[model samples]
Target: MWSVPVLPFKQLISSALFCALSGLAQAGSDLRADDSRLKSLETTDAGRDWEAVGRLDRLGEGFCTGALIAPDLVLTAAHCLYDRDTLEQIDATSIEFLAGWRNGRASAYRSVKRAVLHPSYVYDGTLSATRVRNDIALLQLQRPIRNTTVTPFETDVRPRKGARVGVVSYAQDRSEAPSLQEVCTVMARQDGVLVMSCDVDFGSSGAPVFSFEGERPRIVSVVSAKARVEGNPVSLGASLADELALLEAQLTGTHVGSQLPHGVSRVQVGEPRRRDMGAKFISN
Candidate 1:
């Protein structure tokens, strides 16, 4: 198993964490019991429906899972764009989005031209409700994909606690092909962070969390970290509705902030972090 950082359960119950998560709670029906298992989307037939989800490769360093939100826009975790070692931002030119990547090939390949992180996001190699609540990023491709098979997904509001959700991602063990967990429940929602019973691991960062409530699956959140809540493993993500709007504004120069920096940063691969006060964030 990958040696990941562990946050104490007591810390989560404290006021510091709870204050960071204060927000209005939505009411939704409880999730029905279902067999939650990871199904490999290795075959073309089985993976056709999820063509927009792909691997965000940092060249020789490591990769994180991302999904297309528009013809030239990709959504992922903000931490994925920061180097774990130096806490520096990665260059957009060095990152590539392998849309519908399976086996040894991809449906469409595009280099990232720009990346915008949530303005409130800070990468200090720590985990907190504030960081997780803003742990989202948007990437602009050098060129539009415009592929028939690679249709972008629609974004939606955050799911209520106990709602059923799904995740498709590539991990350390399943690096070549992505796997789908079709039935994970939102265990809790605090402030703007979501804690779900989704199965994720290293390299699963930035993976899209889909809500199947409408006619089609819509992205509700992006996997930020995997944590053990009171001994049960859970995945953490930021509610996309508000955060996504801010990112889009920033990308279009409508938001009041500095433009995204241009430079190169490396990804941290298979590095064990010191067990401290934060959850096991997957930044590889």
Candidate 2:
């Protein structure tokens, strides 16, 4: 019973299709990201079990695609910590996460030290569907990678309409490394947004979206933005069951910024879009 679709980031990117040429394997049948289903963890046994999937850099503003549900959190995409056009909110030690990056070396970098966003994520630029079902975010890592090859990710349940989901991004012509389409699907489940087909771009905003049923690979949504819908090219998420337990109790409470209880507003929906706007909003 979830079919809410407000949709309008200037009419869904004024006629969508922009994730550096997103086709998402043509949405429903060949879950494609070609090259054998989008694999490219940049070798070394293909990123050795995805070393907690990372790359969230922000220092100069430009990057997204995170994952690592613990050992210093991480999870991403609350508009990638804002600042689209002075909506501002960027200072968490300038953010950074790297972890297993590849070729540009990273296996663990850490920096940001505290962050949270899911109190009904009110970024009000009107890209409704409650802003991609409250595009999530979490950070918090100045240290604590406890490496063993980075393992950390676990948050299932939220895959339904056509299930079979998977994605691991870091896009914009494959920035450095991180790509694992692994057969996408989940083609619709509105109101908590999740119209995926996987394969995202623009640094694949907070990428994660996994859901491999039993034995590992859990996550359940994160990407957030890259819609086209009726014309295909989906991808837009935000459904960690109940906003990841209220963002893990506001990331272990103590009333975060503005005294918590739902207080962290940011708005920057379709800023100067049309640079091939396919409903892109992965922030930064």
Give the whole-model CA lDDT for all candidates, comma-separated: 0.76, 0.68
Q: Candidate 2, 262: how far from true, in Å?
A: 25
TM-score of each: 0.80, 0.32
Model 2, C-alpha of 89: deviation from truth (Å): 22
User: Per-residue lDDT for 41-160 in model 2, tens only?
Assistant: 898798787789888877755778888887888787788787655767778678789987987898889898888898767655445556667788778788879888888877766776
Off by over 4 Å in 1: 1-35, 255-284
Best by TM-score: 1
RMSD of each candidate relative to the true structure: 9.0, 15.8
- Which candidate has the highest lDDT of all? 1
Model 1: clashing residue pairs? 21-191
Candidate 2 backbone clash number: 2
Error of 2 at 136 (Å): 0.4
Clashing pairs in 2: 25-32, 100-107
